[model samples]
Target: MSALLQQRSTGAARDDARLRDRLVFGDETAFIDLYERFSSLVYTIAARVTRDRRAAEDVTQEVFLAVWQRPLAFDPAKGSLRGWVAMMAHRRAVDLVRREEAHRRTTLDGRLHAEPLGHGDPVGDQVSDADAAERLGTALRALPEHLSRAVTLAYLEGRTYREVAVELGVPEGTAKSRLREGLRRLAVALQSIHAQDGEGP
Candidate 1:
């Protein structure tokens, strides 16, 4: 039984590796093959996790789109192709849930429900967004190189820590540590800046 399992695993690895190579070279056929092979499983996992058909479909599309764009990120040596794709789908779906829940919390006023809030001043919102972006950019630039790279990749670019690890060519544990420390330092730096400006962080 162990031999059978190993053989199957090896076969899948070889198949995925070939597909990856084809994808890296911009082969449409390979992209189609990957989508055909794993789209259903990705969709099913996402649908189950998010409990939203549309979100599941969006997640599935994003997963395949990511594979299509960065084929090299999928390293067969790290794990089986099926497992990797499934995990990506799950992470993305969970991210969507977290973001949606956060939004719901912000909009909710305790247990009591009321009319949705107004859009407020669009121009003021844009100015505030711009100011925040400028402040964050300045703060990020002040961070140490390693911390800046880690935080930028993970937070700004929306890459998972594992993906950040791959991008930074560092161990996964190291990437996680750097991200945590970076976030802490960034908060301190921003708060200090806020103090200087006589505003809240």
Candidate 2:
């Protein structure tokens, strides 16, 4: 990891380790503090991934509930608590998208006798888009922590480069570099997926 990332990770570990201990002991106030600290970030991730306000709200609630119920599930040794919450929200949001897509497909199948499925089909287009979004999310999760944060803040949250730098406690040039490299990696991931599907980039 870069020096900046290492410093950030160390700080997060220290902060989360203390909170995790309180949570493990069933401290209600600690849980409340955790929620207050991460709720907005978690909700923002859910909202961006699911693109539905209601689903985002549901995901945000579910994430914190799970945290309270299974505090030990969070291993501070593995990652920051904030990252874990954001990841859970993203995962839940993606799951909601998949479930909704499946329901739509089932409903559409029943009406398929009236209109055959083919090119230009709206349902097919939606399915393709959802699949791409899911793949992108997977690729994003696969990125290194600093790069992923930079990309998420800049693209998902629509922050400027300077804003990302300030948020990450990094130089503006570093933020831009991370964003460039992250997007390049995402493009590669998408290309590989397309290649696997027999679709040339």
Candidate 3:
């Protein structure tokens, strides 16, 4: 048993050194090798912990993505690559489950506690809604270029961050960062925008 353990350790150490070297040099092949070695294990960990196939897949992708983007984060002196990867998968999986739970609770609470909308005269309300939407569109156009483009791609075009990255010719991480920053700026822009007839949002 001890012999087998030592053999496994020796193999993992070799992989750690070789892959670490290639990864630091930005080698796609090394990324592929690392993914091939550990992705299934990561997926299984995520799936078991999250109990959602889609979420597990997302978590697995993110785990590998972090490794690819930050190769130096793994230190051979501190731990084996396999252990680091496993722990990352576990932590990310748990985080995903917690976020899912929080989203569920927020959604449930919103449905339970939301103020009921009064529909006084349906036809009049529809006309008013159309007018409000027109004003909102004008306000949206008044935003700065980056904020406008981000908001348009994400909200208007219904693009996810991945799709937004492709559409905007930016990295996926950059796309998300832009969207988050844009949303914050949009709130402030909306307050200042007085469209056509000059009504505050």
Candidate 4:
């Protein structure tokens, strides 16, 4: 049974490698095969993480699209294609959650600032969002300088990773790495703050 399991694993790895090669060669059928094999698993993981069917669907599509666009990004020597796809889905879902929370906090802060202060403790209502936004800003500032700059350009300024790389005079991969690390640190900082306030991050 152990030998049979090992054989099956070896066969699966070869299949994954062949599919990856076809994908790298721009074969449409290979893309279809990959999606057919992994899309459900990706969507299930995304839904589990994001807890929104629509967002899960979006993340699923985005993950497959990324695979189609960058097939060589996956290294068969490092891991199985299924595991890599699953990890991407989870990472993207978490990033989506973080972005949504940041936008909500930002929007709440904007509305607080925009609304006229007259009735029903507008000032009191502003306090929570104001504090959250302030904490977010402070957290961003606390990131390493390169990471903070990459994140600011890519996210806050709405620049693409390529644009951020060009603007910062760094390679695109380096820019992406910086932005990812920056967001991760920012998420940790904000989660800590939210936990302190008895809120979910």
Choose the strongest candidate by TM-score: 2
lDDT by residue (tens digit), candidate 4, 86-198: 88997787688668854422221212212332346311222234566567667866777788877755543435689788988999999889888988998788756755543
Q: Give the TM-score of candidate 3.
A: 0.47
lDDT of 2 at 124: 21
| Model 2 lDDT tens row, 1-201 | 456546655776888888988988999999989987887777766665555567778988999999888888988888668768877887777667667754422231211212322455431223223454556657777888788777766554445689788878899999999999988998789756644443211
Clashing pairs in 3: none
Write candidate 1's Cα lDDT for 80-136 as tens digits.
Answer: 677789889978977886677544222211111011212442111122234444576
- Regions of candidate 4 where Cα sits further than 4 Å from its true position: 102-201
User: Which of candidates 3 and 4 reaches a greater TM-score?
Assistant: 4
lDDT of 1 at 134: 59
- Model 4 backbone overlap count: 0
Model 4: how far is 198 from its true place, Å?
Answer: 44
Model 2 ranges with Cα > 4 A deviation? 1-8, 102-201
What TM-score fits each model?
A: 0.50, 0.51, 0.47, 0.50
The CA lDDT of each predicted structure is 0.69, 0.69, 0.64, 0.70
Ranking 3 against 4 by lDDT, winner: 4
Candidate 4 local accuracy as lDDT? 0.70
Q: Which candidate is the best by lDDT?
A: 4
| Error of model 3, residue 14, in angstroms | 2.5
Worst 10 residues of 3 by lDDT: 108-117
